[model samples]
Target chain A: MSEKTDIGRELDGALQKPKRQLAMVFDLNKCLGCHTCSISCKRQWTRDEGMDNMWWAVVNTQPGKGTPKNWEDMGGGWDEKGEPRPSKIPTRDEFGDAWKFNKEEVFHGGKGKVTYLKPVNTKGESPDWGPNWDEDEGGGEYPNSHFFYLPRICNHCTHPACLEACPRGAIYKRDQDGIVLINDKQCKGFRFCMEACPYKRIYYNHVQDVTQKCIFCFPRVEKGVAPSCARQCPGRLRFVGYLDDEDGPIHKLVHQWKVALPLHEEYGTQPNVYYVPPMSPPAVDSLGKVDPSKPRIPTAYLESLFGPRVKEVLAVLEAEKEKKAKGEASELMDTLIVYKWPEDIFPDFVQDPAEL
Target chain B: MLVKRIDVNGDVLGDPAASVWSTANGETVPLMPTPAAMQPTKYISTKWQNEVYGQTKSVSVKALRNADEIAFRLEWQDPTKNEQRIENTDFPDAVAMQFPLSEDASLFMGGEGTPVNLWYWRADHPARARSDVAHGIGTSRVMDDVSISAQAVHANGRWSVVMRRALSVTKEAASAIQIVPGQTVRTTFAVWEGGNLERAGIKAFSPAWLELEIEA
Candidate 1:
């Protein structure tokens, strides 16, 4: 098997194969950058004393530095030979410290007119970056400036770098559904997971002195309910199901339709979470004429993130979209459209959370 | 090194500046970097491959014992004081004394079935030390019920710390080393420089065990 596709094969018996892997597919085209997923995840798990800076579910604008501020430049995950890649532990400032606002002086102190609210960081300085520091700031010149929202969560990879990085065996992939988690009781606050995760999704909880990330809403998943992020997303772009379930949308999109691709597959972690590449309109010329040569969003930049297969996936998406526009039958377009709520996107986890 | 029998009060024995420590013979234990080959994970070894860490060359040790307890004063030089654990990247400076449960146990940590007791002191928690037991590297488990008293002061680019405990402990006896007077035992030392981001197997340690004799 190619080293790029294999998972846990090079771990030397350290990782165990899960019976079934739970996966999610995010359609970047439909994302509206509303941030409901981020808020839902925060309200569900990370609203604690030390989790002020953690965004377990983040929606970053493309061509931007991302949450940790140029995290792509930081090294992590595995090398081409399947050797572990070393990474730096991102600092509070790099991840953008939770801003402290002067609510007291503005609202309750009876000085609202004079003292307007301002955000101060931990060191009592103005914050330079945040989770969405460069929102809507896409690359390229005027008539063609374009960007898309890339909503991210823990990949819950097949061979998790965080699990292998931990010396105390504190991180594990669940045997039942392959949901990666940190066993806080066994964690010694070493933060090695933060250093090994290529995605840089893990956050350190200073109060608890432990590393934390997206748990994939395992409790809700176990009870036949989709993850909070997917359930709360207004775009209905997130698909959650068992990867091996042939009839499921996740399998169809990932294995059959092959439209969904793993982000940064070269990281060598074999992330279960996949994404359908976003399509952009063609760029316009300086003469105000429609230019069909290239898209406003550079294909090279998209290829850098989604890998070489992005062009092929985008071609398939374009063809299927054209067929749908011509009023012809297209399973791919029908699946992407999601005619029925909850049932079409997540058949296995279609149970409403409110009913539970 | 002899743990001298002193007539000092328990309060004074735990103080790093206490004059009672002057009576005991102090030894400068030489330290070396923990071998990179022994790092528990590949990521850690790779992270340290091009970096300089575990640079602390030596530490001063002095032991003193009273009627009921024993105390050891450790003094080491460090340019920076890192005592905060509030940030993800902040690792507090720490020191640990290791004692083997079996004579044949390894100095690096004990082997399987051969446990080692560790008296661990971190700069963040200044008032107390932790009692931990481990069968091998990366297996250290805290003995929460057992408390080891510690007092530390960082001044003039050097840290003076005193760690003390009962001469004999009954609770968690299997994990805790009972330092009996008039008996010879072996001990080793490891120091973590938080400024260098050293922790776990990435610290400086005495290569060999130092023999200790407590005066009866």
Candidate 2:
């Protein structure tokens, strides 16, 4: 499918331009798949009863079914003709219902010896799936098998399908930082946003009867503090800043170096989250011979996830790495290294959360 | 359809199973599923299109009015009772009655210039009902008034709902359809089966407007 459309362009035109568009760039090569970002996000937001299952920032093993289980196969977002593709609402089971262990029976009950502790869901049934059920289960044979951590959150698209799909006009894109939010009072809990979102990031709060998603930590952003997921990341792989800020690492990595590419650009939402494709070591043959030309993680598979620009981005990264190894001043490599902490990564939002 | 008039001080006729309703011949209105093509494009593209509901082909409706109030008793077969919205995927069983503000208002929720008054009742909220105004599809807004009293009971695979309101409201609402003695009005009905996960436009609706004449 074509990447751009006149309808999408017109939709962008109708919206009031934000003073600055906030963006994020994630270097996949640096990701450790530790899920510190996910845990930090959970502690900050999603601690309620219905929100227990919500993982606003999820790190999934590539080439495997994502958080919602086979979410890539579920259609949403705009098609080639800029029309909404038919989709289905991901069930609680599909999203992996929060499991409840029999703590009382195991610890306090007198018949502890006969009955063992087991995890049961809210519906009183054993859960079959979970957020990281397929964690580290990559694709291909033993010697050629490979995987990379794909951390996902709300893209906060320039042309968000969730915003357009809301009939109540409850979803709005802020004119200041271009953050998309749903107005709780106006939201009728229809869940159209959940279906229209190609990323399947939006979640339903059964207690409140409304749909919820990653808010981009607007409360922190307003106070010049970065989101918990970005701030708490130990890898220092996530860079946050306004796209127009030429001096910021986001612009350097995304536009200047051209190493970061948006995931599934074919989804046609103009996603703001970009990824620096992962490079892998050469694959080994059954005869114990290493094939230098054949990378363990196929480039074609990466291209399918990040679009056709994967090859060029990888080539640029390789060239820059070579320059840096030769003791040359490579600006791209220096930025990726993140010499300073918050100051070098999120220049605009550098205020410490504790200080705020 | 004729709305039988009762003396205001004599006896209340709010019960759905009351013998007074039996005296009037109940109309068996055939209900058809609201076409998927007619639903909002977003809804048509979602899992709702695959929803299998509105299987009930018909419903029995009877109406009665006293000097102070008017009431409608709708009875339909529903094998399940889905009254809770506590679960993420749970949808409540619901029903709505529609009346036009003008004589020539469109039967399909009225047009832009012509609005419709809607009394919506859900099984989850059994005590009271919502008063809403709709200009057209996707333009429904709940008004800030608790003007209608609703009570529903499910038994033996059947649902009996009674929705009642005063003949004249003290407060004025833009979409309120005036109900007076010796007046003829057009009305429509919609039912949602929560077990089938039906909500919004995915429902069974009366194909044509039913003309009701209030007895003087």
Candidate 3:
């Protein structure tokens, strides 16, 4: 273990190849609450059997049911003692189905009064829902309801919860570049990783009778190429680099600038992917009673995702906001390199093959 | 040559080069390695390679088990796009696959014609695939993995077709077809549509694509 195995060496050589890890960092503000990411990921990964039900990457419209519906509330990843947490498999309706036209109605009845339109199940069965059915769709009244997209995938963690949960040691974290992968040959399909994962990114391939997850594209990374999804993104929101690269954006965001924060940091998985939490609009007076002009990014919402430490971070952010408002630059985001559109900041991925 | 002599020593089938008519005489023809090679690749944990002979230009070889499948990564390229084929008047175009049976030897070549389904698999013997022919898809086929894709060839000329199979000797097979830029090479394969060594253990016979590797 001390000398790094062949795979470890392979991963080591891959890190400096300049092809990069190819990670997507969605800007919550610009997400538009669209299910484009979910649909794209599904087409690329789950177009085959067993993977029919899988959405390796999903976009959740927050303040609403997340994919695998209620994944956040499941409390997997790791317990206080670091044991794995079990998870519930999502139903077909949960992920949603591909939209279909009522061809039967259209074919037989010309100009039918009521056209039957529904999502078609790949298997010919009428699945109730699909991967993106509920995206941007919430159940609430006007004014109070709110939503934002939370695109998710395997964190490929520094201390992966799923990696530790596999009893057969079928799962491994490559020491060279730290990509957590399941050796399909050794995987028992026990799905311990599925349960151990806090983000519920691992999918049990029923057809293969084994467990599979995001690979971080080892072949491409080793060959100095990026993953398909990251490379093909139409929105340049993806950043491909190493966490250890001090000059890399990931390093600066997670450690140095400390702007990007992990979701539910209390889970203690030390996830590598971090989110720079989006700021929300101020609350409204639903009752027309209590004043609703309070600053958005509600303390409750922030605390729930980032823990109580969010309070201190928000205070600094607000003070900086005040100073900047009065003509003085805020120290909060000053040292931080904020990328912009057509560039890195709020960058859109160029996943559109047609465009290329 | 040791290559022709070796085939004569085994239960030699009909013309080995009949299906190879399109191949150049100088093209490096890959022969089956030692029987022990049925063992999986050390670098690639989920792959198995071997070579076999047969007749005709097309046939179907089926694995005798319920859990094995396959994909052929042919390493080839054509400057003039001459002999390289994209479709055969009757097949879908894409990667090809076959199911493998328990205790059967790994395959050296399986044509890209079977349809792929959720419960699809090859039922041929893993330890003795070469000794006998494989099985054919019956009407009773439940899990569908038998998919033939030679129809998707949009290119007009000789295109490099890697018969990538979703072969399942184990629980799940790694769908590793994403080419890694300059590190990966476009390979070639020879396809035979007919063969008949199918003796006692043999079950079926069909078109097969034998993978060929080239060194610079």
C-alpha lDDT values of all predictions? 0.90, 0.84, 0.43
lDDT of 1 by residue, B131-159 (tens): 98989978888887677999999999999
Which of the predicted structures, 2 or 3, would earn the higher DockQ when compared with the native? Answer: 2
For candidate 2, lDDT tens digit of each residue in A153-190?
Answer: 99988778888887677898888887889988878777
Tell me the DockQ of each model, to 2 decimals: 0.77, 0.41, 0.02
Best candidate (score: lDDT)? 1
Could you say which candidate leads in TM-score?
A: 1
Instruction: Give the backbone clash total of model 3.
Output: 93
True contacts kept of each: 0.78, 0.30, 0.00
What is the Cα-based TM-score of model 1? Answer: 0.97
TM-score of chain B of each: 0.98, 0.93, 0.22
iRMS of each prediction: 1.2, 2.7, 17.5
Residue B153 lDDT (model 3): 17
Candidate 3 structure quality by residue, lDDT tens digits, B1-216: 011111121111122222331221223333222222222212111111122422222222211101122222122221122221111111111112332332232333221332222121121111111111122211112222233221111133222332222222232222122222122222212232211211111122222322222111
Docking band of candidate 1: medium
Q: Ranking under lDDT, best-scoring first?
A: 1, 2, 3
